[model samples]
Target: MRQSVGATDAPEVRPCPECGTEVTVHPWYVTWCAACDWNVDPGAPDPERGRLAQVRRRLASRHGEQLAQEIEQGAGGGRGGPDRSTVLAFGLALLVHGVTVGLCFAAAVLIIGGWHTGIQPVLGVLLLVAVAVLLPRPGRAPSGPAVLYRADAPGLFGLIDEVGAAVGTTGVHAVVVDASVNAGVRTYGYRGRRVMFLGLGLWEILAPQERVALLGHELGHFANGDVRSSFLMHGALRSLAEWHAVLRTVNHDSIVDWFLNALTFLPRWTVYGLLHLLDGLTMRASQRAEYLADTGSARAGSSGAAVALLDRGLLVDGVEAHLRRESMAAARAGGGAGGREEREAAERELWERLAARIGSVPESEYERLRRVSARRGHSVDDTHPPTHLRRRCLASGDPQPALVVCDGPRAQVVAAELAPARALLARRVIRDHAG
Candidate 1:
């Protein structure tokens, strides 16, 4: 975000507060010394707005600090097999699944045994409906535009496979490329084939080594045995969430509504209690799994790259803001989605442009972001430990050589492979701005 003092005015020079370095003050952008990084993030981070958000923030902070302490003391080693908490959480999850199973069984019995009774058919239908609604739905393999199967990009897949081997896992079945500024891994379909999502927003901005770090961290989830992400636990938690969602939408205008709400209150509260318990039981293990994933990133891409990978996350907001501004400016100039040629050009050039834009950010901006993280407990998102702590944890580890390296020549092939994804995302961005 840069601006001129005026069309004819020269940009002003400002002295740094922390270090008396003379710095050029670009209008509308932050004024921080490249030497000392003072007041780059001058405003307070917005407070989380609601009780649930506040609780999540506190929990993330608590877990981050505690896990960092454990790492410091060398007591955070991975334990094989399910812990007591994992066992108990799974037991509770099974009970939740069992409730829906029982409903289906009862519906079958009622429908079969009382075929002549009109009331039994209605009751059975209701039970069946409830069972259908509560049944765990298996995720399907990701498909459609921009979804890259292994055959489509062997170089990318080969790189991923090597990283997977380094982290004691196998290659992902598919790769989903999207515009989101994040990445994640998940299982899909009955076979639970794993796929990884790569957000080009994050991907384009990463250096080759950091890209390996990103892949290492996501693939590490499978090897690390993060039970919370397993189908059984995640399915149960998702089911319970649906239950809560259904229970909370009370219709407020009738005695029947009041009666139904009252009748379901106990079950609703019970489900709520179980959800909290399962979350509590898994929280520590989940946090530790995250740290293990970070370690895997370090091993796969070197500790220095792993730390830098996390540091890159701090630039997400700035990157996103720049994208929006670019989109808007292009739209106003009658170029965005206005002509086929212009749109095509953007499609081809956007990734390289984005990479260049973020790559050019000054050192002071990153420094400020690091300080802001300490003040605000910021992360890539709530699911992560604080970025600062993740960096510290990576720093504490012994430095190692990269298991998977994507050199300049190899990266060009991967870029050529991603041409389709680049076009798809560019068209979307341009069309959105056109609207």
Candidate 2:
């Protein structure tokens, strides 16, 4: 996954068995192709054929028994299942859009509405500008060699050791600041040494076992080399969004802005629409990774313990509903009028309204709501998956053959490893507030 390539050459593509879409053959790649929701080989030969063959053989073996029953009952009635319906709906949507655009063009000529003569070109140019701005910048790539460690924060050093040992990798290093309930592993330094960001809030809220599970997930990212690849992809998208934002801000006085404002608001809706699309894709992937992480944690520790931790976290956090509200608030704030303060007030009002709709609950319930808000949902910007699905995955038990060990020594080992980081972080909290 960390194999570096020079700028001069194009990466090779292999057809994915899952979707039959051409996917880049990279060592660290693990993604389903967008065209078809198939399990892709990043750089390996087609496994789909083999997989299908195995399935056929299994079906053949049971053909006389289960197949006859299934046929008699007409169980396998649908063609390609709901996926076909999804594809058909998508095609119809595109066709409808095309027809609508055609109709609009025809209407523009017949009616002297400003939408026909002036609005269209400005919208087109704004989109072009957005594309130009949001595109990723290319340069000398960051290497993955040197380890950069930060010990300034409390529990900073101990957290590193615990997480490093949990993942069985010495490739961990570096610390970054994040205010949100956001913490994760990443590659850093000139050589791209793995780094982990342990969020202050996350550390404060979750219990020891839950923390370990979270750390394990981060370690999984590092071990799998997902950090570097994600960095590159996310960096590109962030760069483009930033550029588009800057350009939009600068061009506020331009005719393009006016045209955009005329057409159900410019760049805002367009940007958000793109973000929602990306968020949908990301959420799906995140959900899958969450399941894998739960399995990984179960393998590393106790499945029962993992499940308990997830259940507790979900109960304490109330993460899902809270995140949904936050997302709605953010969207409202972004689209609202007035300055920052005014928009924030409006967002707050919206939150209050939403809370009111839920009706008055106990203090405990309110606290739960707060926890949910703090956890947040799968955002277009988020790297990790949602916590609810993670809990479900843990509850589902290990997906493969695994043992459930309740040994004291192993548990003690994990506790001992995590203690220093926890203590250090706790002290850091005291010092910050004390000052």
Q: Which candidate number would show the highest lDDT if scored against the true structure?
A: 1
lDDT of 2 by residue, 362-411 (tens): 23333333234233433333444445435544554434322323245554
In model 2, state the lDDT of residue 335.
Answer: 43
What digit string (tens of lDDT, one per residue) describes model 1 on residues 137-228? 77887975589988999999999999999998998999999887999898898898989999989998999999999999999998887877
Error of 2 at 221 (Å): 2.1
Estimate the lDDT of model 1: 0.80
lDDT of 2: 0.44
Alpha carbon lDDT at 264, candidate 1: 91
List runs of model 2 lying over 4 Å from the truth: 1-170, 175-182, 200-211, 224-229, 247-272, 315-388, 398-435
| Model 2: residue 429 alpha-carbon error in angstroms | 4.8
* TM-score between candidate 1 and the true structure: 0.86
lDDT of 1 at 380: 22
